[model samples]
Target: MSDLIPGLPEEVARECLVRVGFDQLPVVRRISRQWKWEVESPYYSRLRKAEGLARPMVALVQAQPTADDAGPAVHKGSSAAAATGGPANFYRMVLLDPAEGRWTALPTLPGPMESIPLFCHVAAADGGGRKRLVVVGGWNPETWAPMNSVYVYDFLTGAWRLGEPMPGPRRSFFACAAVGGTVYVAGGHDEEKNALRSALAYDPEADAWTALPDMAEERDEPRGLCVGDRFLVVGGYPTQAQGRFVGSAEAFDPAASAWGPEREEGLVPDGASPRTCCVVPGTERAYMLHDGHLVARDGAEASAWRTVAQVPEDARAATTVSALPDGRVVVIGSACHGGEQTVYVLREEAGKGGAVWARAPAPPEFSGHVAASLFLEI
Candidate 1:
């Protein structure tokens, strides 16, 4: 490769080949030989796609720094610190680097329960180089209650397996994305009561559970997305009517199993009370943070809903919004008032009335637990 691109320094080999991922950077260019032709050059692959650097800003598996190297430290604790008790308050397996805002915390989940609230949906594996990370399902304290048990978590083995489960008993659901390997659980509110249109899928390589074709509009905290392969469900409030947030919208097409017409299309932008969303994988745009604003949709063809940014009025009934692969958009640990909780991060600078809202850096521990955020690549 022309003597490894004439001796290195192409923006530090394109940020170490986009943090070591271009099918594993030729084993770090075999120890030397001018970093294996400046990371198998092509001008470091067009300066790694004009600096969009494809993927991997985080992929976590740390915990080897000893001799006071400051290893295990991500204690921004407080999801009410496990109610200030004597044991149960755990955390480890972290990777929050919104372009270096920092928090690494990995190593520990060999299972005895030292951490498990990174709440489901953290998949990535299709030549994108392996990733799973699924935990935080319900009950199961030794089968004392509700739990369709699922605990995959294996970013190439800091391990923990046992996938496939979820034909029933899920815990407050509404996740949307993860096509081929399955996982598209939407609309849930069961303890044996209301809300649940039953649209399941969890096929981690056929460990199995498949029962799609449901949603005719029976949302609980509705708001799902998968754009390209189709499965866009919006708005919630199954029933508990006071005016239950239901502007409606549906579209599920797993290659024509059918499900497409439920359009009420109501309040989606600052109309107040629909809150709860997640989806930014490969993008067509979709963000709906409820009430204080952050409603956007670009699915197109008469699909209008905008307010782009204005969060932090304590996030009005906050239901947790997270979509960070660096394009930034986050809201964590909801539910405020006395048992306080808040975490926001959305900044689009290039100033003069663009996109702004920043408060992130205040989770010394959360209260009223429930915080979800995923984008692991490294």
Candidate 2:
């Protein structure tokens, strides 16, 4: 029998191929048909994870300036709009390695239209031994209308494939979270701008969405977090209270197929909504960016929210707050909207007071407003 890969035993070659980083997967795939088949197979991703070779990556949906908007100062080969004549306000997915501080642009999402929607919800899912980035409903860039399109990008294949479109009416600004092997989406507004209570869960293996019970109340642009097995949908408002949101939050138990009663008191409190909250994995506490401070609450306790650490004065209203797998918290924001962006990492010391925020280096291209950010272990 011939070796599966060149000049090596089949078993040894497979081990080496699984260790290849996701960034180099595309190039590795082009090496040969056997190499491509091995990389794209479910067994490969499973082996990568089992061997502890998968790396953590941060993906951001960011706005990119067009050639005209960029003032005709084009770099040698770094302009997407200059080559394609796409829309002036374009958005693309950019990946960053927080440890290495390196940035690489992925292939633009393949869609009938050239532009990405506004306020799209994005989540990363590792299911069926495959790692994928899932982008849920958002508004049409050209018409400013709601869309139900669901797109999944496979890191192994370096390609984007459309998943089953979200069932029913178009939704925008929905809350989405990946728990275990499933991606759950809830809330958001419809075409008429009415807040929706509908929710659904998608299984990557099946490539289908299963509708879950509607939320107790209409919530548009709510924040979602998967703590343990429950998916919590936090503070968002109805059409009447569009600007002012309620302080309540609700939790959905997929196993029970029902949503718990909404807590009317201090789930989100004042000045903090779902968009400003994040949960650190393996911790029982949920953190929120509230009034220039980082606050925490025991998920088990109903109303015991307390301050954890003070956020940097400049990063008051952060656009994204993500919890790294290593228990570090990263906050990204700009002094002014779409102006110079700054990233802060908060690390907790042993027996020390609390986490102290330190500035971190971010790519110059990430200075634009971050529409969405997700942390994925690939």
Candidate number achieving the greatest TM-score relative to the actual structure = 2
lDDT tens per residue, model 1, 243-281:
366666676777886778644555353234444565566
| Candidate 2 structure quality by residue, lDDT tens digits, 1-378 | 457776888888888788777878989988888887888787888788788787777788877644444444422122344455634456777786777777777777775454556778887887766778888878776566778888888876788888888998888777788887889998888888899999999987689999899888898878888777778888888877885777777888878989995465747875456686887776657777787777777675646778878888677758888777676777888666656667787876647767787887764544556677777888
- How many residue pairs collide in each prediction? 15, 0
Which lDDT values do the candidates have, in the order given?
A: 0.54, 0.76
Root-mean-square deviation of candidate 1: 21.1
Off by over 4 Å in 2: 6-11, 29-37, 40-43, 66-87, 262-266
- Per-model TM-score versus the true fold: 0.28, 0.87
